[model samples]
Target: MRIVFIPVASPLHDEKAVQELIHQYKESVKDVDSFTHLITSEEDVQSVNIRQDDVALIGVLTGGTEHLILAIAMRVRATALLPHPTQNSLPASIEAQSRLSLSGYPSVIIKEWPPEASIRSYVKSWKVVRSLKNYVFGLLGQPSPWLVYSSGHDIEKELEERLGISFKFISLDEVYHEYGLIMDDEARELAVQITSRAVDVEVPMNEVIKSVKLYLAIRKILEREGIKAFTIRCFDIIKSLDTTACLPLALLNSEGFVAGCEGDVPALLSMVILKELTGKPGFMGNIAWVENNRFLLAHCTVPLDLPTKYKLRTHFESGRGVGISGIVEERTKVTLFRVDPLTQSMRVVKGKVISGFPQSNQHCRTQLWIESSDSIKLVTEPIGNHYVLVYGDYYEELKWVAEAMDLYLL
Candidate 1:
């Protein structure tokens, strides 16, 4: 990644001193591949070429160049990183950043020379945000009947505007059509592969074959539609086809595709964001129980890659089709987050995996006991029933992404 530095200095300042300051600033971050160009006037701002992936660093050199800096920032239409050097640069950066924030453009001000690690983090965040533009997310069937607040045309518009992603809603009929196209021998072969990796297969061979065929169907749609991430109204399949989407969703996630259940668009969006930020699949689950500093998250499906060992079980609710009973490692650091489209906000909480229990029939198949101080917020200030969990401490990255997307972080 290239850092294209646009140095903004007022003509009132001594040119030689400004040049020296710019030289020092470049030397400080010389470890990075960066190029500097002076923006002395409005005409100079026009010469700056800030590409989509470039880290546009505004070298704030003097106090009177706020307008020039803002102009350059506006030209790129992305989050600007303003590193303030000595000689009135800090004041200028504050002014320009304030304007950018007030106008709803994201900008960050660095009062000191940032470490190389911080610079890389900033660039990663910037790239994640840029990667959202024009990306397509598929919604297989409408959101489940119970997700009233999480799905709608209004919510889609709000998401599209905030994240710059498009939503594609494919009917369940299409998925079923694709499922029917898979040959029995092909499905059986894939099912054997999946069952061979499992600690045990408690479900019937036909059910496992059905699940694998569903996975193949959805994979086909994802490839054909160029979908980056997707969610399914999975319960509909259980009712219509006497099968569940648990295994398919888990398989999709294991293949590095971001997939969610219940057609929870907000949860799906949260998973997509987490995947982009951390390059790990998120396990979307229901808030089964929450106490003061601990909680239980359960779901019928989990990313196959997340579990140390897993069993193929019947769907927890219907007890008819394939579900995953995954055992996650204890004491693993994890982050739980949810995006609320109605509020345009995100709630992130860090926790450690205490243990995983799959013996309960009352809850979903894969269950985890998590210890988090912020678990009470799940009751006091709820975003929704579903939260996406990934196995790592990605709180900082999530905060950066929320800020870049202008979503309120809780």
Candidate 2:
């Protein structure tokens, strides 16, 4: 990532003072490949090369910085401000932000001239999100029966216009019928490869193999459609073909493809956003229960790479099909988020995996206990029943995403 330091100083201002400030700015961002260009006059801007890839850290050192801003804004739509850390410059910086927003540009506001550690991290995530747009997300089948109000209603058009992420719905039967066309020997080999990660296999090995073949079939469908992320109406398969998509979902996520279970659109959206911000996988889970700072969260499956220990079990609800019973360790930081399509907002919570919890048949097989710093708020706050889990504390990243997409963050 490259940072272009555009220091704007009007003719009336002291050039030496601006030079001192620019020296401090360059010193702070020394780790990255940064270019420093002082803008003493509007003509000075013409000499600087403004690449589309570079992020401008515009330093408002003097009154008439708008000329420099106007010149840069035409070439680059994404910009961040490095305002002087005094009361006098803050209002000006805010006004600049408002002007940019009204003009339809994505902007970031760093309060201090030499930003803190958090600001640097935020800018990094923002750069990743800015370049990612117009990608396709596949929704396999519909939302699960219970999540009708929460996720079933398709809001793909709204999301595409807002975030530049498109959603394409895939017919369930179309993909299922394609499974039979796969070679039997190939299915067997794929099944063996999938079950290799299981420490204990409770269901019949043949059933697991069939489940693996189903996963392979889904993979082909996803590739054919150019879909990289998806959510499956997992329970429908169990009811129709007497199998589960849990293993397939897990394997897909592990391979860097985003897949949410129960065909949850919001959960899938949350997963994609997190994946874009962090380049990591996310797990969709239920808010099983809460106690003090610790809460029990569970899902039938997670990315195959996440569990500290792995086991195979029958799907909890139907008492049929494959489910994974895995353990995730304590004190692992994670980000929790759920996109509310109705409000076009994302509710996020940061917590640590406190320990693995014993599961009851009433809930999904795999379970984890999480501890939140603000546990009471996380528990009491009214959020979507389902949340997506990614292994990191990305508070700043989510904030930027919400702002950039005009989605409220709760």
Candidate 3:
């Protein structure tokens, strides 16, 4: 059994007494695989047989909760230590001493707290470590818009060869849906609270409800599946929940659970790795936009507000053969383009496409041009009507254009 020791000491100042507490507790749970003992007092740590116990340690100090969380995470093999309701305000030195004690490990949070959001973050992360432990990889991500790029079968095969364990792609959606049927009091209350916020009623409330449903369903699914860490897209829904969920969610994270925006796979992967490497919540990715001559792709670790530049400024040229067209803005990249039945083309004569919209002068063609850093211009024709621009970082965004459009990179 995993043993997580969360110490709750008072503001008393007896270093030796604190040392005794650590020794006593360590001795009592020494038989477990590992111990995650939270030290809130300045106590001299006991000399437990490290090799015999295979101990991994994590320290949670009062001031460095984030750092402490990360420190303990590095020693993940440690047992699941519960937070003692008492030691809420431990000092920094104790936290440091505790972390020093447990190093080089992997951990799993026993309970999914806060109760508002799901613990998929924890479940999915442990799944990775567990897969690694079992010698498996190639774990495909669950199907969610945010996780669309994550490939499970690929990860599974990789892990199997790399680590020796195998992971099967399983859909958490089924159970998620089932769980949605029985909403809990807190969930309903959360939903009601969301509705109480002034929202655009004309926009279907079903989406909001679906998000609430997803939040509730995810927790149930995690509970039933015994998953420790996972990721999902919840920005739209989460933001809609307003500020009420922030404080509560932060509290949950302080206890070890994780959460993020837009189910971004890289962000999820990054956070998981960070947790394993350091023992703290993972931070989200920065947003980026990339464009060649043909299409524009938008990307971010969290759910993004599609840049205003890309907002459609004109109706379709023929309303049949053409699609939407506008400017796209990434962090530093920007482009103006229009979509036709064949391809999504970039601007040739800056406002030309706009003019074509019944007197707007926007260029509406299937061909695109890219400007090189050296000021050289390279115009590319459609490859059977589509352009392909390489994302310098593979994580860049690009639009899915129709047939007949062509792209070129200069």
Candidate 4:
């Protein structure tokens, strides 16, 4: 991503002062492709060609930043203000943004870094925005009846139109048909690979093989349709096919494809971004309970690689299909986030894994007790019932992404 440093300098300021300010700005933004100046009333704003998808860094050297900000925003849709070089720099930036807003021009503001140094966050976020062009997502079957926070067609279409990610619908019947048509040997091979890691297999051999069949079928569809990420109506699969998709979803995710449960579009979309940032898929789970700084997260299945412990089990409610009982390491860093379909907003928080829940039949089999730095938002401002949890601290990347997409981060 190239950056054009638009230094708003007035003739009243000494030329030496403006040069020193530009020097500091260049040192801070040391890695970008290019830096050009648009000195106030001296350089022709109309003559500058602001390229598409570029971020303009407002170098607040002197007064009269509005004209420069407006000129940059006119051609480049996104603009930013880097960390201030001096105390007065920030106020100048804010004043410039205010005037731009008054004139109906918008600029993204990055105030403080979580420890900054990762200036690449803005570049990475812009890359995600450009990379999503023509990206396809598969939504297999309808959302579960319990997913009250899920969206309908209008919201789905709106997301597709606004986010540039195409969503395609696939039916359960088609998946079932493919499951029945897979070669017997392929299912057996997948079953062997899956059962090799289990501490104890509670599922019957036949059902285990069927889960493998579903896995192969889903993979076939994803490869054929060019679907980068997918979510399924797992409950419907359990009811109609007499087998749960837990194992297959886990395998798909571990293989680098984003697989979400309950046909949750937002959860799957969050997973897509996580995969892009972390190079790994995330876990989607219900917020079972909350207490002070700690909250409980549990799910029937997760990507096989995430857990330090794994055991096969029956689906929590039906007790007739495959599920996973897995454990995450205590004190492991994690970030949980969810996209609210209605508002197109994302709620994100960083935390550490505190402990594992006691083995029980009541909740989904896999459980994690997470302790957040600030739990007030978890209690007071939940975006939805479920959120995607992935290992590592991606707070800056998420923040930059939210900025680039114009998504509200609550």
RMSD of 2: 4.0
Model 2 agreement with the true structure over 1-410: per-residue lDDT tens digits: 35566776666777677778778767665334456577767677777777775667777776666656767755664677777764235666677778887888767777754675645665655554554464687888877788755664357667666556777889899777877777667778767766776777788877887778788889999999998888888888887777888888888998988888877777777887788778888878888888888777888888888887788888888877778887777788988888777777777788998777545777788888888865566567655677888788888778777765567888
Sort every candidate by lDDT, greatest first: 1, 4, 2, 3
lDDT of 4 by residue, 1-410 (tens): 35555666665676887787678666766446567754676366656545865677666676545566666677776677654545365666777677766776547656653214645677667667666665787889988888776757776786778777888899999999998898767788768767887878888777788888899999999999998788899988887889999989988898988899898888887888877866877998988888888888889988999888788888888887789888777889999988775786888889999886435679999989889866667668766677899998888789878877788988
Ten consecutive residues with minimal summed lDDT in candidate 4? Answer: 110-119
| Top model number, TM-score | 1
Model 3 TM = 0.31
The better candidate by TM-score, 1 or 3, is 1
Error of 3 at 283 (Å): 5.2
Worst 10-residue lDDT window, candidate 2 = 27-36
RMSD of each: 3.2, 4.0, 17.8, 3.3
lDDT of 1 by residue, 1-410 (tens): 34566678898989898888778766655433456578789888776666554557677778888888777777664545555556777877777888988997657875566434455565566667777775788999988889877778888898788668898889999999998899878899889988999998998899999888888989999999999688888888988888999999999998988898888888988888788888889899999998879999999999999989999999999998899999988999999999898987889999999987575789999999999999999989987899999998988777776766677998
lDDT for each residue of candidate 3 in 132-186, tens digit (9 for 90 to 100): 3532111223434434333334533443443354443435345344544754454
Count of backbone collisions within predicted model 3: 66
TM-score order of candidates, top first: 1, 4, 2, 3
lDDT of 3: 0.32
Please give the range of 10 consecutive residues that has the lowest summed lDDT in model 3. 395-404
lDDT value, residue 12 of candidate 1: 90
